[model samples]
Target: MSYEVTGKLVAKYDTVQRTETFKTREFVIEKSDDIGGRIINNYVKFQCVQDKTALPDKFNIGDDIKVSFNLKGTKWSKDGRENYITNLDAWRLEAAGSLAQTAINNAPDNFVPDAAPDDVVDDLPF
Candidate 1:
C-alpha cells in the first residue's frame, strides 16, 4: 500500500552510492500539526532509491510538496544480532498545491461554480 504526505521540504541530500549497482538519496520534510493549544512539528525523512534518487532534484528546499510513498521494513542478522530497518520509500513527488491550482486555472473564464447563494439559510443547530 502507498501513502501520501504534504509538507514543506526541509532538507535534501546528495545521492549516495550504496553499492556497485545501487544508489539512494534522502530528503526531509517538516510537518506541523496542532494539538490542544500547542503546535507540534515533525521532521520526516524519506528515501528514494535507484532511478528515483533524482526525484528530489527538481524541487528545492522550503517548497511545499506532496510525496507518495510506500512503507518498507527489512530484517537481517548481523554478527548474531537481529537488526531491523524501516524506510519510507518515496516514489512520486510533486508540488503540494500546484496540481489543484492548475486545474482551477485551466477552467474557462466563463465557468461558474455551483454554490449556495449569499443568503442561504443555516438550518444546522449546534
Candidate 2:
C-alpha cells in the first residue's frame, strides 16, 4: 500500500552506494500539528533507491512538498537475535496546497456568495 504526507523539506543527505548496482539517498521533512493548544513538530525520514535517489534534488530545503511513499519493513536474524526495520520508500513528490486553496483557485472570477436568509439572525455573544 502507498501513503502520502505533506510537509516542509528539512534536510537532504548524500546518496550512498551500497554496492556496484545499488544506491540510496535519504531526506527528512518536518511536519507540524496543533494538539491541546500546543504545536508539535515531527521530523520524518524517507529513502529513495536507485534511480529515484535524485528525487530530492528537484526541491530545495524549506519547500513545501507532498510525498507519496510505500511503508517497507524488513526482519533479519543474526547470531540468534532478531531485528526489524521500517522505511518510508518515497516514489512521488509534488507541491503542497490545501484542498480549499485548490477550490478557490479553480473558481470563476465572477463567482459570488448567496444572500443570507431573512429568518437567520447574526446575533451571537462571543
Candidate 3:
C-alpha cells in the first residue's frame, strides 16, 4: 500500500548497511502539519534504499518536502528480546507545493538546463 505525507526535512544521513545484506539510508522527517495531531514535536525516521538520482539536488535541513511511500514494519527475535521496527520506504519525493509544476517553475531559472549552453548563444538545433 502507498500513501502521501508532507513533513519538514529534519535530517539527512549517509547510507547505512542493514544486516549487511540490505543497504539503506536513514533520514528524519518531522510531521508539522497533517491529519496526525501534535506530531510536530515528534520526528519520524524513514529508512529507504539510497537513490541519489531520485533525490533533490538542493534539499537541505529544514526544507519542507512531500513524499510518497509504502509503510513497512519488521519483527525479529533477539535473545528473548522482541525486536520490531517500522519505517516508510519513500519512492517519490518533491518540494512541498500547492501543485508539482509550481515548484518547478518557482525554482531558480537556472536550476536545471532546458537546453545546451551553446544553444543559448548559437544556432537552434531544432
lDDT of 1 by residue, 44-94 (tens): 999999999999998888888889999999999989999999999999898
Each prediction's TM-score versus the true structure: 0.77, 0.76, 0.63
Tens digits of per-residue lDDT, candidate 2, 33-52, equal 99999999999999999999
* Model 2 TM-score relative to the real fold: 0.76
Error of 2 at 30 (Å): 0.2
Candidate 2 regions exceeding 4 Å error are: 98-126
Global lDDT scores for all candidate models: 0.89, 0.88, 0.71
Clashes of 1: 0
The candidate 2 region of ten consecutive residues with least summed lDDT is 110-119
Best by lDDT: 1
Model 3 lDDT-worst window of ten: 50-59
**Selected candidate, larger TM-score, 1 vs 3:** 1
The top-ranked prediction according to TM-score is 1
User: Which model, 1 or 2, shows the larger TM-score?
Assistant: 1
